[model samples]
Target: MDRFRDRQQAGERLAERLVALGYGREPQVLVFALPRGGVLVAHPIAQRLGAPLDVWVVRKLGVPGHEELALGAIAAGGGRVLNEEVIRGLGIPAEAIAQVEARETQELLRRERFYRGERPPPELGGKVVLLVDDGLATGATMKAAIAAARAQRPARLVVAVPVAPPEALREMEALADTVVCLKAPPDFRAVGLWYERFPQVSDEEVLYLLRVS
Candidate 1:
């Protein structure tokens, strides 16, 4: 059975788990949502915990013909993580890496501008940074986000998701100080399969959440 009705319900239920874990009581807490769908999953959590919410843009660098297969990812403030094994196995060239990075860098900047206007990104130093995403797949995007959050030197770094495959959750634990995945079903496949009403989150909704929530 699907565990969540939608992103909002997932966020609410996830927040309850976080609160039980004592994150809701922590000082210097900041919720950073991986934008678009993640923002939806983050909104209610941030609201429930009274933590300030912000967006972190991470772009996936997909393998050239198989665009869905991520070779690497780029995060805000020039943070990046590359999959050396994938690159070597695919024999991807350095030039291709540079090209993909450059393109994603531009897209990252565009998202920041569109989302925040003239406002600068929130500071992460000395804070308990909660990285929220709807779910984890290959985890490339969240890995880049973890690197980016680490660059800012947060006091603590955590990753929270509604559902994820057990293997990916285990791998993410090495990068994040705490990983709170509500569901880690052994038969995991796509993230959407665990939600009853999964749908594409629009840019307008992301902007609205930032402004209103």
Candidate 2:
């Protein structure tokens, strides 16, 4: 498959696929993007669907030192899901998990404040919510986001991404009412690999996108 020119292009493609799948005309649709990368991808989708755009902040509980390796993740509204296999395999103690959780929870709140400001999060009850992310890897953060969304009693929950591994999509199927993945290459590595210009999306960019919409 050809790599997307950038996140915006990937999002456009995802939006097209989503519309083809019968989501474009839904009146109750709401787009909850996982910032900061998801914001760029979601803005176009929101515009195309004429839906409200918002952020769903989720923080990874990274393993000590090896910060890229996620032990689990925590999302807004006190939703947390830990990877027990990773924890036990790494011999991470309960105390370590608690510490990591505390730290991540703080960061999650900080991000929420930074992104949404004084505005309370939008109510999801009875809404068909679309959880947008640039891509999925370990899927920990997305899982936590799904849990948090479930707490709000949305009428329907869907997870959408431009690219993800086949295995990750399979795992997400049981969590979300629908999972829309554009590309699930067998040799999938990182999400960036499928994009020609996967730049680091800055906070300023996220703020601009949120304010513009």
Runs in model 2 lying further than 4 Å from the true structure:
none
- Residues 71-133 of candidate 1 have per-residue lDDT tens digits of 999999767889899999999999998988888899899988998899888888999999999
Look at candidate 2 and give me any clashing residue pairs. Answer: none
lDDT of 2 by residue, 89-145 (tens): 999999988998888888889999999999999889999999999999989999999
Model 2 earns a TM-score of 0.98
For all predicted structures, in order, the TM-scores are: 0.97, 0.98
Reference-based lDDT, each prediction: 0.92, 0.92
RMSD of 1: 0.9
- lDDT of residue 178 for candidate 1: 96
How big is the positional error of residue 170 in model 2, measured in Å on the Cα after superposition? 0.5
lDDT score, residue 148, model 1? 86
Global local distance difference test of model 1: 0.92
